[model samples]
Target: MEAFVSTEDEPDEVVDAELVPGDSHLPVIRHQTPLVPDADPDAWLPPEAAQDVADGIAQATRDAYELHFTQFAKWCAMEGRRHLPAAGDSVTAYVSHLTRTPREKTGKPYSPSTLDSVIAAIRTVHRDRKLPVPETKGARQVVTGYRERLALAKDAASRPNKASPAKRDVLRRAVRTLDRTTLAGRRDAALMLLGHACATRGGELVHLDIESLTPDDEGRGFTARLYRRKLKKWQDVGVFYDEDEELCPVRATYDLIDALELEGHTTGPLFLRMDRWGYLAPPMQREGKTIGDPTGRMTAEAASDIVERAMARAGQPGRWRSHSLRRGFVNSAREAGVDIVDIGRHGGWADGSKALIGYIEEADAFSDSNPLAQINEAERRKRGAHDQH
Candidate 1:
């Protein structure tokens, strides 16, 4: 198998390789070689086949894999151990190191999910290189042990970091605070309402275009055609007219459309970036021609920030994130007596999804079926009977 090579002049000695914010001194490793060296170039994959192989995974996943693999390589270089075709013991030791090490900025060790991703990244790189993936049973056991430790800790950081739901009340308050006349306000209003109505993820919200929306025959709502990445298909979600015009998703959509149409943008991205001065950023271009591009659309991070800012403005405290809309929809629907399966379908959750089931369980925690609720009701009835006697 090919050995990892550093880009630095001295191969034996590791250079500045700290992974810190604003630190550009991390060592780069040249890792493009095949896992097993071949004397004949014909042993390598054809260019087209290699391209297809590369395209198998999503770009975001590929980016993450590259980052995690690079970090692992740096650690190996620092420890004078082989990274590519790594030994099982080395993999276990690395997991332990990550579990114990805390980030300089956050002063917190990597979460279980992050540690899992690191192992996945290592496996992916090996698989991509046509190498046998290193044994991960020990590495997985280490992660499981860490998870058990966190569960025992029972602290805020140990608990799952769930996003606060933007329930109907919270959404209403947040939308009412927005200035409807301003471009940013109108965009945000539409973004939030439509996002909630469709139970959209941040990426889905930003990827929507004008062409994706179609009004219903009764003019009572709009059907948004969204491509579900997880399901790998297009699904239509209904955004109905609300009784309260102030919080109506349909009204918000039209208002934003009218505003954008007035600005000579009747197509392309449904949500766009706006400068502080209230000017919409123009569509991105390539070779003097406008193209459908991410640069012209709102980013997932920006969408989350907007939700966080809206919640702050409404004085609703808690950790609100982009996922709040989807979660809020599920919880609110469950409270309104909507069937669990229907809620899952509307929110694009696969049938019998454990995640959707978990949300339902949380929403039902204090409902009529709970023992505590039944006990409280019985106590109230007993007191009322005594008072009557």
Candidate 2:
């Protein structure tokens, strides 16, 4: 199959090249292959070219783009439309179809932001192929129109399923369901608590290593050092314990570590995948799990699955997502009158972010001091005063 390779000079030039396969888990372009060793040796990329490409985009972003591209390709195949260097009309039609068509599993149409991602993926793919994306004409207008329609129809019909906060009350109740005697239970319990206390994303949670944890001198809790991908740096965030050990992330984490027999070893992953028989792997067994350049990190998807199963067991079916842990921490903090800036800092949100504002809004919406409740309270007080008079 034909592919494009980046040259130091004339980067936009598309040349006929054979596709070299990479890790089956990742897309083809991510792998480094010999570029037919061009006639001009200087034209060849440095050995680090593949790493350069991978580093240009976040791994999560690359995965999302690949998924979107695959979806578009499948749709094109089904509809008999051109995918590579697709026409403006074709891109618009795909977006339109996504907006209108409900997914088979969820029975819900794609949100406006999701459609935007699909477009981004298309643009990225076209750029990679050294093809000009038809970014103009009716296509841009179609996207604009879809956004307008989405805004106007801001009812439940147009909106995606609303994410509910995993409040303290809900989480406290959920923690009870875990069979703490079992290794899986201890790991999951710790995972949930740490996820909440740290306000960590799935990727961050899964990437944690034993060494990433630093015990506080005060002995109150521990600091979890996480690599923030968006910021492209490492951040050490504090994870404090609750008064109740049952609900304490620090304690739970320690208990999990003890259960796994990884104490005093500041290496390997903090969390490990359980065996088929629901047992934690001994240190000896773990070596086989890391066959190929493994960071010993669990996949974000696995972390999400852990969250899903735990929440389901907690009787919170369809009411939460992987984001619930992070969102819950923010929501709970805000409800406790924590400053918005503090909440943002804790959750790794950028200052004055629209995303931060959305979380604050959701937290306020379900608050006891919400507008509707305040209005109802005022009306009741007024009626009582009038009756007494």
Candidate 3:
């Protein structure tokens, strides 16, 4: 279960004894004990160490950590480096690989910040294990900065990648044109509202259900109470207009509910999907993922897949993802001159959502995706060409 290295002092005979049974940190565990090193991720964590991690994190957090760990393990296997779980070097190399290598499909390299996340994932595991580790970029500011600089340099080497405004326009155009008459349109509209409403994370939108949503029966409008996954708590954001006007968060969704012959408490699902023929029967829920009934439920993963499928149905590009809706919402709101603070509150953002501030940052702020600014530079090139001629 262990792969070991020999030190010069050990004369090339040091066995991977400590790593075997993966309780490498265990203090002389007996062979009689039912030890399973394979079950333990990294074997670096003694049972005590894992117990400490268990104490430090919630069950869900631990589950997430394990999930990420599993993914990192799989990525390592794909790269023919399954020995990584056994050594810190493997972890570091894997982090470096994520930063240095480009994805095969997109051929796009990870951003500096994205690469930092990869490093963070590895360091988290080591920290949980209480293992001795080198001062790496993820955990240390200096190392992180260095890694970011390296990542940026690689990006430069690749080319100054210019994101085309045409890409954004194409998606927006499609969303604007989706059918609004059928039940499908209402569902799409509801999806659009969330995506464009706050540029909501796809995961947040999908997991949103009946119990959490509140609608005013007076037909004035409704309110949605979202259990925000990223923030680890619930935050309420209401979108409803007066008796005369129509400005509700899920107004389109409400219309869909009526069109589909659905009714319930404010606690019922806001959006229950119908079959291809527009059947209104609820789908079975994945148990424990939610409460009581297990039908007509939606999931973030499923939401994303649904969005993609819907986009394809709408004749939009495949790359028009759920996130495109969120970004579109943010972009459209900003363009309409809606203040950032107001935008944040509507989007269910917590106070000091500095991490999500980039959504409000104008394209000209970075000029990274501002084609208009980039286009002006071409005039200088043309002038230079004329002068030389």
Separately for all candidates shown, the number of backbone clashes (residues 3 or more apart, or on different chains) is 0, 0, 10
Name the 10 consecutive residues with the lowest summed lDDT in model 2: 1-10
Q: Name the lDDT value of residue 193 in candidate 2.
A: 88
Per-residue lDDT of 1-389 in model 1, one digit per residue for the tens? Answer: 11223344755654567765765686776677686566565658877887777776666677777777888888987897888678777788899999899865699877888888889988877776656789999999999999889878864555677898888889999988899998789999999988888888888888899889999999879899987766667899988999888888888988999999998899999899876788887565689987655447888878999999999989999998888988888878888889998898898889999988988889888787678999999999999999999
Best candidate, lDDT-wise?
1
lDDT accuracy of residue 331 in candidate 2: 84
lDDT of 2 by residue, 295-316 (tens): 4455677777777777787788
Models 1 onward score TM values of 0.83, 0.75, 0.58
By lDDT rank, best first, the candidates go 1, 2, 3
The Cα local distance difference test for each model comes to 0.83, 0.75, 0.56
Model 3, residue pairs in steric clash: 137-143, 195-325, 196-329, 199-326, 210-267, 210-268, 210-269, 283-295, 283-296, 285-294
Candidate 2 TM-score versus the reference: 0.75
RMSD of each predicted structure: 9.0, 10.7, 10.8
The TM-score measured for candidate 1 stands at 0.83
lDDT of 3 at 203: 63
